[model samples]
Target: MITVKNVTFRYKGNEETALNEISLTVVNHDFVGIIGTSGAGKSTLAMALNGVIPHEFAGDFYGEVLIDDEDTVDHAAEYFGRKVGEVFQDIDSQMVASVVEDEILFGLENFGIPHEEIGIRLEKVLRELGIEDLRHREIASLSGGQKQKVAIAAILALEPEILVLDEPTGELDPESSQEIFGLLKKLNEEKGITVVIVEQKIKLLCEYVKHLVVLDRGKLQFDGVPREVITHIDTFKRLGINVPPVAELSAMFRADGSYAGDVTLTVEEAEKMVREVLHDSV
Candidate 1:
């Protein structure tokens, strides 16, 4: 659903490029997670996916970004806006309305969606995002998690094909972060929405995302299955990102010659592998 080809961008009066010949493809309905340390160009890459590179930010650009076979550089921002829905790290910055219902309807209204249809989309989004009870509540009164949900509902109301999130859980507590991750998983699995999330929370992301992409200093470092990425625990540590707890434990056992099986990335899988090893040894 998205493609970047020889894409490189440098800010004005800057000596270095934020992205260095970066190229990636996200297929339809794939859930991709991007990880990296601070200043790793993760956010810059996310912006390029939806045409926020040269279009919204002034900079020198080389290469093409295509979404659904249309070139983002050639098209207008309004055209790109309809195809991609973005949720930023700060929920407050994304909010344009005071009430939940108004916030959800804001995008649809801007797109010139009809008045009657706006009501239908708003209801569907509220129900799908599990915010129906919050429909009439004040945005200021909602909790952090609720605020994030409302932000997501507002984006989903646009009916975009791809959802791009920049640290959606950055400001929330652990419990609230889990809630946001769960909603992203549901949206990707049940609704078949293409998801691309840039996050620092590797442990939570490993639970849901099918693919992982790591960046370092504006370069693509790793892009593959979650299991494969986590197997190199040392590399992840060096990059200042944590391996899933299960993966770390499994690695320890492997190092001690206690288990010689496949690397596990989830809690359940790690448990099963360890149990078999113990049983064999007995």
Candidate 2:
């Protein structure tokens, strides 16, 4: 659904590029996770995906970013808005409406969607995101998790094919973060919404995402299946990115010549692998 080719961007008066010749493709229904330390250009890359880099921010950009086969850099902001839906880390900053339902319907109403259709979409989004209980609640009264869900419902109401979230769970507690991540996984699996999330919670992402893209110093350092990326514990550690705990434990067992099977990224998989190894040895 999106293609970035040889893309590079440099801010004004800055000597270094925020993004350096990065290239990647996001297909339909793919759950892609991007991880990097502070100033590693993860957030900049997210902005570039939706044409916010050069258009919204002053910068020199080179190369092409195509959304649904259209050149994002050449198109207007409104055009990209329809193809991409963005949820920033700060829910307060992205929210424009006071009530949850109004916020969800705000974008659709702006685009001239009929009032009747807006009502239907509002209900559908509320239910789909499991935020029905928050429908009439004031935005200011919501918890961090509820607020984030409402924010996501607002973006989902646009019905964009691609959902780009920058640390969507950054402000929530662990339970709320888990809830939000579960919804994202369901959306990707059932609705086929292509998801690109720039997150610091590596362990949560490892549980659901199909692909992992690692960035370092404004460049693509790794891109592949989740397990493959997780297996590189030393490399990830050196880059200041945390490896999944399960993957780290599996690696330790492997080094000791005790684990003979595949590396695991989840707790369930790790438990099964360890049980099998112990049973066989005994």
Candidate 3:
């Protein structure tokens, strides 16, 4: 549902491009994860997906970004905003309304979605995110995970077909982070919403995201299934991704000829593999 073609973008005064000749395609119902070191263009790529690049950032943007076969450059930010919902790493930056209900309503109001439909949408999103009780809570009173859910709820009420998240769980605890990921996964798998996330938390991400895209120095280095991508452990390090301990152990096992099956990217998978291997040895 999304296509980026040889896109190169540079800030007005910067000599180097933030994104250089990057091309990618994401189909409908795809859950794609983007990972890389700082300045690798992961966030820049996310902006491009939803027209935040040329429209909001305003750079020397070259090439094309298309959503649903429609070139993003041809439309205004509002147009693309209707098609893509974006949640950034910082919860504070995304909040406008103090109360949770108004926070969710802000986007729907801006979009001119019917007022009658607004309440329904708001209620649905809050219920779906399991934050209905927080409808009247103050944004500042909520915890990091709660704020994250509110941020997502605000965008979700807009009912956009695609969701783009940049380090969404960056400020949350481990349990909270897992909850956020679980919500996103449910939105993707059950609702068929195309989900794309740019994250540095590879260990947590590897367990949920089915597809992985790696960037290096503003270029696409790798794109494939996460389990398969983890097998190329050295490439991840070269790209500056911190390989999770589980992934590292899986790679070491493969190298020693003790585990020849597909790479494991999650703790559950690793545990199952270890148990099976030990049983066979006994």
Candidate 4:
């Protein structure tokens, strides 16, 4: 479990606080998505989760971030990094090796894992990400989605309990975005890894994340189940955040008293509701 308690932070030389007394909890195996407009501190919060806020960045940070009751401030970022693996928004910035297999091998070797076990971990993570075929491929030759996958595979090779990603699919197309979200869901359910992702795609979050957190100008605005949070359509609009299209459609119907159900987060849910209403009318 991760506990963020009333955390406030301001970067050195910056007058504005990047995070303001934010408090939240993420339990074991939770798949969480953070969404907000630009300068909303979404990326800052992701840094806090992985112990990068107070450790790597020069800043005035107040309050506590605990992982399973362990205080993050007491340890170096690298220490917590072993348990909370982070993938940055820029996939290329984190790549250290030329080949996919060597990239995954880099972390294991640096951690001083036995040479015999390196290959085992490498094969396992590749298979887990379904990227075994790309093992021998050059990092420069991979596409955006494939590069993102390789970046994630490199992190997953370390077997962190918590995976915090800062806009992993920002550059990918819609189909590729869905594939990444689906893969994260699979990892959360199958490996029981706690996933925290900062995503701009509202529809993807609604479909995959168990919880959604919204931030605005360094303050947390909304935090709850995606369906419930997206119900505040007006608030989202005020914040310049986009509500999922299906959710907007459901809200439109509800306004006219034609739909009596909760906000629909997905197209399938909307379709089912329509079918039910049609059946009742007939």
Model 2 lDDT, residue 8, Cα: 92
lDDT of 3 by residue, 1-282 (tens): 899999999988888899999998888899999998988988889989988889988679999998988998899877888779898766688789989998888889998999899989989999999999999999999998998999999998888899999998888889998998899999999999899999888987788887899888899888888887777889888766778888788778778777777777778888988886677778
> What lDDT does each candidate get?
0.88, 0.87, 0.88, 0.92
lDDT of 2 by residue, 1-282 (tens): 889999999988889999999999998898999999988899889988888877888878998998878898788766787578888766687789998888887889887778779888988998898778889999999998888888888888989889999998887788999998899999998998999999989998788799989999899998988888778889899998888788988999999999867779889999998897888899
| Better by lDDT, candidate 4 or 3 | 4
Residues 109-129, candidate 1: write the lDDT tens digits: 889989989989989999898
True-vs-predicted CA distance for residue 136, candidate 3, Å: 0.8
TM-scores for all candidates: the values are 0.95, 0.95, 0.95, 0.96
Best by lDDT: 4
lDDT per residue, candidate 4, 55-132, as tens digits?
989989999999989898998888887799999887787889999999999988887779998899999999999999
Give the worst 10-residue stretch by lDDT in candidate 1. 82-91
Q: Compare the candidates by TM-score and give the number of the best one.
A: 4
Q: Give the range of the ten consecutive residues with the poorest summed lDDT in model 4.
A: 272-281
Q: Supply candidate 4's per-residue lDDT for 221.
A: 92
The C-alpha RMSD in Å for every predicted model, in order, reads 1.4, 1.4, 1.6, 1.3
TM-score-sorted candidate list, best first:
4, 2, 1, 3
